[model samples]
Target: MTSTALPRPPIKGSRTQPIVAGLVTSLVGYTSSFAVVLTGLKAVGASDAQAASGLFALTIAMAICAVGLAWFTKRPITIAWSTPGAALLAGAAAVNFGWSEAVGAFIMTGVLIAATGAIPWLGRLLAAIPVSLAQAMLAGVLLQLCLAPFVALSTIPVYVAPVIVVWLIFLRLSPRWAVPAAMAAALGIAGFAMGQAGTTFLVGELLPTLHVTAPVFSLEAFMAITLPLFVVTMASQNVPGVAVLASFGYKTPWRASMISTGIGSSVAALFGGHAINLAAISAALAAGHEAGEDRSRRWIAAVSSGIFYILLGLASTAITALASASPTGLLEAAAGLALLGTLGAAASSALSDPTSRMSSLVAFLIAGSGLSFAGIGGAFWALLAGLAVRFVIERKRH
Candidate 1:
C-alpha cells in the first residue's frame, strides 16, 4: 500500500521561496481588491481617468512605502491601500461628497494617520474607540457591496453567474485566489464584451497620469469621510497589521511606519487616491514561514512584492479601461466576492461580546440603512448612535 505520510520539508527554506511568496503576495493583494478601490473612487464622483489615476497612485505609493520599510527594518512589513477605507468611501459616496471635497477628506485622513504616530495621546484616543463599534461600522459599510453578487445574480445572471461559479470553484480549491480568479473571469468577460463593442484604445490610454486636484476641505466632508476613514484604516489595517507581524516575532516600527504611510497617503490624495496603511493580509504572507525559514532574510519577500506593485501599477490605466467597459454589475459582483471574507470577519467581531452586542447592532443597522442627516453620511451617524446607546445602557446598569 502507498504511504499516507506527509513529505518532509527542507531543513532550511529555499532561497527562491521568499521570492515566489512575494510575487504571490502582490498578485493576491492587487487583483483581489483593485475593483473595490476603483468602484469607491468613482462612486465619489471621479471620472474614469481620475479613478485610474487614483488606483495607480495608491499602488505606487504603497510600493514605495513597502520597499522603504522592508529595506530599512529588514522585516517583512507590507504596505497597502486601505481596502476597508475604500469600502467606507463607497458607502459614503451616496451623500454626494464632491470629488474635490473627497480629496480634501483624504488629505485630512492622511494628516490624522500621521498625527497618530507623531502625537502619542491621539493614537491612544483612537485605540480607545470600542472595537465592537468600529467593526460594526465596517460590517455595515460593507453590507451593500457584499450583497452585490446576489443582486447581480438575480438581475444579470447571464453575465454574473459564470463569474460566481468560477469564484466558488476557486474558493473550494484555493481560497486565497478565489477573488482573484473571479476577477480574472470578470476581466475576460469584460474584454470579450469590449471586443464585441469594438472599443478602441490609444497608446496614451494605456499609460496612467496623475489627476491632480486642489483639495477643498469642509467640516461636513471631515465628519463624513475623514474621521470614519481614519478609524477604519487604523482599526482594521494598521493595528491588526502590527499584531500580525508581532505574531511572527517581528515588531513593526509603529511611528515610522505610520508617518511614512501617512505621508504617502497625503501625496497620493493629491493625485486622486484615498489612503494607504500598514498591511494586515499581505504582511502575513511575507512574514510567515512560507516566505522563508530564515526569518531574518524574509524582508526580501516584502521588497519583492513592492517591486511587483510598481509594475502592476503601471497597468492600472489598461485594467481600468477593461473594467470601465464591463457590463453593469459584473465589477460589482467581483468586488462583492472580494469583500465576503472581510464582511464575515467584521460581522463576527461586531457581535462577539454580549455587552456591546446591541450597541454594535445599532451601529450596524444605522450604517447599513443608509441614513444621512445634516449632509453627513450614514457611517458617521452610525458611530455616534452606537456610542450614545452604549453610554445610556451602560450608565444605567452601572
Candidate 2:
C-alpha cells in the first residue's frame, strides 16, 4: 500500500490552502508547456481541429486521472501529459504516414505503459535500461527544440526578442514563472498582431471540440513513434514523478497510478492526444509545503488541480487559435524557452556517468542528426546505436 501521510483527523478550514494550491498547480502546468504540446501534435500530422482535440483530450484525461487516482490512492498523485515525449514528437523526423498512424502509435505506447505496471518483468526490463543512455536520447531529442529561440533571434528578432527578454527577467526573479511569463507575452504579441492584421477570431473557434479518427497501425510508425514515445515518457515523467512524491514522504501507489495513466492515455489517443503520464516537474506545487503542513491533506490539492485542468480544457480551441495566429517563431520561442531547463538537466545527467559517456555521446549525436531509414525515424536509430556502442564498451572491459 502507498504511504499517503496519515492524519489525526479532519481540521476545520484546512481545505482552503490545498484548494488554492491545486489552482496554482494547474495554471502553472498548463501555461508552461501547452505550446510545445500543440507544436508536437502538428508536427506528427494533426490538423488544427485534431490538434485542439488532442489538447482538450489530454487535459481532460489527465484531469480525470488526477482526481480519480488521488481519491483512490489518497496521495498527491497529480497526472500530466508527457511534455518531454511531446518534445520528442516535435523533433521527430517527418513520417510517410498520417495522423491515424500516429494515433495507432499512441495506442501502442499506452499498452506498453500499462504492461509495465501489470506485468512484473516489463517494469524490470525498463529499469535495466541504462539511465545515461535514456537521458542521452532525451537530451538529443531536445537539442533542436532548444535551439529554436536562438534560431528565431537571427530570423525574426523583432517578434521573438521581447518574449525572450520576459523569460530572462523572470528566470532571474522567479524561475518557476519564467516560461509561463514568456507564453503570456507571446499571446499578447499574437493578439496585438491580430489587431494590426484586422483579423478576428470566429466565435465558434473559441470553443473546444473533439475530432476522433480511426487508428491505423503501421510498422514504421511503431518504430518511429511508439517505442521512443514510451521510453521517453517512462524515463522522464513517470519514474521521476514517483521520486518527487517520495521526497515529500508519499509512496505513490505504483500499480494503480500506472494503470490509471495508461488507460487515460489509451482513451485520449482516440481523440488525438499523444500521451499523458504522472506529472514530473509540476507535481511539487501540489505536494509541497505550500499546499499544507498537514501532509495528509495534500491529496486534496491534487484532486482540486484535476478539477482546474478540466475547466482549462474548455479553452483548448481558443488557445490553439491564438497560438496559430501568432507569428511562427514567436510561439516557437516560447516552447523552446520552456524546454531549455529540461534540456540542461537531461544533458547533465547523460554525461554524468564516466564509463557510459561514450555511449551516451553516440546516442545524443545520432538522435540530433535527424537520420531516417526505411521510414523509421532518428530516435529509434539513436537508441539502437547507443545500445550497440555500450555493449561493445562493456565487452572490452571484460
Candidate 3:
C-alpha cells in the first residue's frame, strides 16, 4: 500500500531578527549623537530642562515621521536628527545668539527644507549638487567626531579599551552588532565609574517634560545659523540619505521624505529642537538586506525603529541623567566608534571619480578646516570652492 504524502508545511517568515536590528540601530543612532544635540542646545543658551525637552521632542517627531513615511511608501525610510546641523549649532553658539533666536533659526530652516519639496526649482537646485562635493563635505563634518575614539583612548584608557576590544571582535564576527556592543561596553564602564564615585547611574524624572521657547528672528541668526543649517541638512544629510536608499535598490520618494522631515523639524523647533532630516548612515542598517530577505517586508524594520525611538524619547529624562553621569571621553568614544564606518564610506565615495578629484579634495580640506566667513560656516564655503573649481577645470576639457 502506497501512503499519501502529506503536503509540505508553509515556511513562516521570521521577523524577530529584523525587528531586533531595527531596535538596536535606533538605540545606537540616538545614543551616539544625543550628546552632540545636548551640547549644541546648551551652547545656544538653552537651560538644562530646555535641552532635555528638545531631545525628547526631536526624537518623538522623527519617530512619527519615520513610521508614517515608511508605511506610506512601503520602504525602510529612516528619519534622524541632523547631527551635522547640531555640530553647526555648536559652532554658531559662540556667536552670541540666544536660545530664542536659535529656535527662530530652526523654524526658518524647516521652512526652507519644506519649500525644497514643494518648489521644483529648489529641489532641482539641491539635486544638481555634485555627489563628490556632498560626500566630501559629509566626510569633513564627521571627521572630528570619528577621531573621538583615539582621543578617548589617550584620556581614559581603562574605560575605552574594553569598548574598543569588544567592538573589534564583534565587527570581525558580526559587523551589524559592533556598534551596539561598543555602546554596551561604554555603559558598563560608565556605571562602574559612577558607582566608584558614590553617584547613582540612572537617577532622573522618568517622565518627559515639554518646554516651549518663543522664537525671535534676526538677520544675524538667519545668516549665521538658519541658512547654514538649511544648506548642511539638505546637502550633508538629505542628499546622502537618498543616495543610501538608492544604493540599496530602494526607490525613495525624495519630495515626500523632505516634506515630512520639514514638518517634523518645524514642530520640534517649537519645543527648542533643531532640524530633523533623513538618516544617511543609519538608513543602511534598516534599508539593507540585513533588515529582511524579502524587500517588501523591510519597512517593518523602519517601523520598529520608530517605535523604539518613541520609547527612548519617553525616557529622555533618564537618558539625560545617564549621559550626564558618564565620563565626557567615554561618550565621545562611543559616538566615534559608531561613526567609523560612515567616515570610511564617505571618504571613499568622495574621492571615487578621477575627474572630480581636485574639487572633492578642496571641499574636504575647506570643510574640515572649520573656517567661518561673515557668519557662514565652512560647509557652504567648501561647496562654493568645489563648484568653482569644477567649473573652471572641467569646462576647459570641454
Tell me, by lDDT, which candidate is best: 1
Where does model 2 exceed 4 Å of error?
1-13
Model 3, 141-201: lDDT tens digits are 6677678789888888888889999999999998767877787788778777777889863
lDDT of 2 by residue, 104-185 (tens): 9999999889888899899999997888888899999899999999999999898899999999999999998999999999
In model 2, what is the error at residue 323, expressed in angstroms? 0.7
Give the TM-score comparing model 2 with the true structure, all chains together: 0.96
Candidate lDDT values, in order: 0.92, 0.90, 0.81
The better candidate by lDDT, 1 or 3, is 1
* Ranking of predictions according to lDDT: 1, 2, 3
**Model 3, residue pairs in steric clash:** none
Candidate 1 per-residue C-alpha lDDT over 245-362 given as tens digits, one digit per residue, 9 for 90 to 100: 9999999999999999999999999999999999898788999988988888899999999999989999999999999999998888889889999999999999999888988999
User: For model 3, what is the error of residue 126's alpha carbon versus the real structure, in angstroms, after optimal superposition?
Assistant: 0.8
Q: Give the lowest summed-lDDT range of ten residues in model 3.
A: 9-18
